[model samples]
Target: MAECPVIEADELEKRLGNSIIVDCRYSLSDPEYGLRAYLSGHIPGAHFLDLEKDLSGPKGRHGGRHPLPPPEQFREVIERIGGTESSEYVAYDDDLTGASRFWFLCRYFGIRNVRVLNGGWEKWVREGRPVSTEVPSARRGHFQPHPAAGMVVDINWVRRMGRGYVLVDSRQRERYLGVHEAIDPKAGHIPGAVNIPYTAVTSGRGTLRPKEELEGVYRGLGGRPVVYCGSGVTACVNVLAMKLVGLDPLLYSGSWSDWVSYEDSPVATGEE
Candidate 1:
């Protein structure tokens, strides 16, 4: 098997002192949830990084709900978190969503030594590993951002690409079918995207499925895929899952929200 982009909890425990462990626990419904959890207790030496403030940029007419911060801005964030280009980053959330977002962001900005913590915070706690409430002082880190081209595709590109690529909707089937939309002004999905909810990549325990299992799940998706979701957060979970199976997929960062922002863009409901 190829080297996966995930680091298991036990492996993380051994690397805690040397690596930068970021507690990326976040809730879309409650912005303060992650910080509160971090303050209450987190992995020893782990620093808290907020999703909205740190991970995303200002929302506007387009670019979806969670936009990527500018390269320099992201570089500053890396420095604030005491992360250098050479530092190994291990990001964790209660589930893989937030951590996967961090992982994708790091990769998009060309930070190569980043990985998501497999099974995340819940698994760490379940294992009864060490936890702490102490927040460490920021150490100045010399990190530079080199944003990778083609790592993320904008809405216009997605529009041009059309159904040529395997367009994957990483949201739940209901959201894809326009049954219920918790967020975004409109319901349904891009005209041709197929539903492949991010949850399929994980087991009931919230950890990712075995590599072979994940390969089987994505095997028939056909070639390199283009993955998207409500606002581009969970889509990275699919990207991570694909990488674990040795498949490289592109991300539609603007995703469905940006798609709906344009009134002329077509939307489809019901399963294909």
Candidate 2:
């Protein structure tokens, strides 16, 4: 929530010339969908960032489907997007997930001046805002990434985290309960992790809810919140939600997918 600051379409339009706007529209089901969408039309002067290619690292035995991109690769993305320490960076996506993902990475890498575009590209296009097929190349930036220590946690950390932390499962209730499993191999969630679907943080219009509503969504959660979802993608929504409510949250980058990769990792089903 820088408590995940967001820029509305109007404000973004006004700041388009000064801000580094990126189009991060990606679909998990279709690997090439995002690039095709960008090619069709995108925000004027917006650069495209592919989800798998740019935002995540290579998948192997176990780091979830979308682990954080390598430092050098991500730094290149930042520089390509003209992300200087002082520059304002704005990101937008179709489902808002990509925007939040972009925002989380920006903060994780110590870029403090980044924000998601409110309501995403849907809102912008619905309002008849400018769209262009021509892509723009940004001037290379001198931004060096300063990754925050412990902002992200690994499997061992989560395994031994104990009950001191509030482990929030940022997935749908069904997914958390193991009633409906799709992407990952095993169903169910981390033991002791409370269900707080990432969708709770946003309005139906794909914009973040007001602070009051966000507070309601996270009420009664006291300890430090550690959030995760399938492959750690949607988890950013919950992370951003915690940020909005003035709570510093940690990301379980491996999420459920990684948890299940280990045969002995405990899995809990149904509501506690």
Candidate 3:
């Protein structure tokens, strides 16, 4: 059987000492909130990774709000976090959003042995697992980045192949429907894209639904669907969910943010 990409809090607790645990808690509304939360308490030995600083690159006119950083820079960040290529990485967040992003980034860069903490930090705290505020010392790591192709699709690729693939919008129903948009300039989703809010893949407790359930949810979407969201962050949740059910979906990293940047591109409002 294939290795599971999601690890429970108890499973993670046992592997904490050997694996490189990453605390990916973050707030889109308050960028510093994640760091504050991490400083207050985190899984011992886990390093904090910032979404804007560590995961994304500078926002250009076309690359959307949070473009991925250069591959070399990402590798450097991994090494700084004391992660070697061979290190078993386990990432988590209060919600699964940030944790999924970390998992996707590592996988997109071809780093295996990385998993997301199933049920996330809330479950850990609920279980009365140990937490710490002290930061860990940096250790030299030998992580050589080897980015894998086909895992991600840029804006150009989305425009070109979107018609041929099932373009899935992983944003909330409201966002997908253009009911309300708080961050981006425009509302609505890409033309012809179907909405499948990432939350549907998770249970009421915020943990992923069973594989059989996920398979049922993704049924008839066709194989190798392409997924995206407001920017490219929460979309990882959908991508991760698809992986949990043995499906490999491509990520439209630029997502709606990039799609709207082009004045000529079409946008659809309301349910399709």
Candidate 4:
């Protein structure tokens, strides 16, 4: 395929019936809800991949909630889900964070033909395009994945947060503030991380807000940046969003999950 920049919902709508579209509107925090939403209706020919179950491997005390699956296992998932050498994949969600995780996984596995659906499934439904209540059964794809090293970072790298490094958080204001304490044990955010929240960067059409707007947000941060969320996944979306704005960001793979797990790590509460 050509260069895979983010594509508009209209552009994706055109390819839906004819292409391999995956509805990745999953919540590791709420898998059942996401699946129920998908079962109710989804883009025709679209398949579903849950972030916790399908995209990520089993969680461990050290691996965080949505740790990356091993390459061989991920390759199995790719083939099982109909991802092939010839298959061009488009992943989307009502929430870009979930969709972006799949996109980031595709990149990490060196699957080059994948792209994020601009505006995602929510935009598709609003436009009155075709949708299906039944999930389609797909033949196994012949695709194999090669893992990329530079795409991920570990805890040691994350500890080096400043200097030339920038850290971004993708949680909402409420959750970031430690006001909401439902998910992780600790509710506060990592000290020194800026709150970007992911959603504020998009337009109504499901595409990114203009590059100028994004540049202003990144430049406002004033340095090379690293992004994170409750886990490492949504943070990747923030990085991808920044990529749309022409800003290349590093990934804090452990993210807040790892941050909070340690007793001595700094935590900040409340909105700023």
Candidate 5:
């Protein structure tokens, strides 16, 4: 069995100065704040990764705010940012959005030596870790992405799920139930998909639960799970959490947004 992709601050501290600590904090409302915080102070050896500028490409009709960067492009970005085939990566964000993106991308690309900071940057700063003001000079490295087979599924692929794929919606309950609409124009979820909001995968304080707890929450569903959100991005958080609990889930990249865009797709509303 493989180890999970989550690590604690203390465990991370023991490896400091000898490992790659990536800061994935960014705000769509005020993007500059993350960079400013990095410039002011970050984990002593941490490298800052911008969500829009680094992890994702320009949004198009097909993808959302943080679509996965092209493979070669991300291979280069990861290497240029000090990631190597053997490097053990620790990614963090004040919030998990950015860190979760990093976690998913690395896992998707086949970078195996990676982990998410359980409580992210807020906890790091609170622990009084050493900080740095100097921008890092990256050393290019070799990164080979070995995406788990069937980890990503598109709209056409999802249409085949009765064959055995399980679609799990990661949106909030209200949105999943069609009572609320905020981010995406679509209000409901994919037909036959069960709800397990991304936020629920973690504690109120934003740390993942014990593997035993996660196993129970997911096993109760009684099937292999395929995770999805409005777009593909946030769904990775759920995937990462599943991995933490020993479950491997496929991601539906073209999630609710893509589903609703098609005239013939089915939609379901109301709580079950």
Candidate 6:
């Protein structure tokens, strides 16, 4: 079995100096929130990754709000952060949702040694762990993109979905139901998609819930799960959950935003 990418606070603290800890904190509402918060203070020695600038790519018409960055540009980011094939990395934010995005992107780009901080920044601060206003510079390192195959699928793939595909919407129930739309223009999910709000994967304290609990939420879903959210961001939370529990799932990289972009695409509302 592959090792889970989620790490607890205590383990992360001990590995601080030995790891490339990335602060992936962001707020969808206020785009500037992440950098502002980072400037105030963050985990000692942690580098900041803006959800929009660093993690996501230049958005075009069809790709969602947060498209994957161009491969060469992303390679530059990795090298700039002193990441190499051998570097151990940790990403943390207010909760797993934010950090999980970094975890997913790194692994997809072939940086397999990264982990998301379980319980994330909230847990770290609540436990009285150290914080720092000073930033540490890292020595440059070499890296190359080895994009993983079949990890992502585009909108056309979703349109021609088979009965065997288990499409999952990672937004909240209301958003999934089309009862309360906010970010995306559409108010429903991909036809036949099921609701599994990413929050279900985390505990009240913001850490992942027990393994068995996760299994119950995802096991025997009966097909390959292709998860998406309003855009392609929070869906990573569900992707991280499924992978953590030994399940293989694909990400609909453009997600609902791309889905709704096509004038003729189908949308399903209410239960299921």
How many clashes show up per model?
Answer: 0, 3, 0, 2, 2, 0
How close to the true structure is residue 216 of candidate 6, measured as C-alpha lDDT?
Answer: 96
Structural similarity to truth (TM-score) of each candidate? 0.97, 0.96, 0.96, 0.90, 0.91, 0.97
- Per residue, candidate 5 scores C-alpha lDDT tens digits across 154-232 of 7788887774557899888999999997877778878888898888777755477677777777876667888888877
Off by over 4 Å in 4: 204-207, 270-272
User: Model 6, range 203-250, lDDT digits (tens) per residue?
Assistant: 874588888999999977889899999878889988998988888899
| lDDT tens digits, residue span 1-272, model 4 | 54545777777777766668878876554659788888999888888887777788777887577788888778887887778755678888886777788878888888777788887887777878788897788888876777887777777777765587767888778888888967788888877778987777877635667778777767778777778888787786677778776676777777788878877777898755
Query: Which candidate should be chosen as best, given lDDT against the real structure?
Result: 1
Q: Evaluate model 3: give its TM-score.
A: 0.96
For 1-272, candidate 2 gives per-residue lDDT tens digits of: 13347777888888778888888998888989999999999999899999898989889899898989877888999888777777788989976788888888888888888888878888888999998999897778877888886899999999889665889998999999999998999999898889999887888756888889998889888689999999888899788767867888999998998999999999999987
Per-candidate local distance difference test: 0.88, 0.86, 0.87, 0.77, 0.78, 0.87
RMSD of each: 1.6, 1.6, 1.5, 2.3, 2.1, 1.4
Question: Cα lDDT for residue 61, model 1?
Answer: 98
TM-score of 2: 0.96
Residue 111 in candidate 1 has what lDDT? 84
**Model 3 lDDT on a 0 to 1 scale:** 0.87
Per-residue lDDT tens digits of candidate 1, residues 12-75? Answer: 8888788898888888889899999999999999989999998888899988999988888889
Model 4, residue 104: displacement in angstroms?
0.6
User: Which scores greater on TM-score, model 4 or model 6?
Assistant: 6
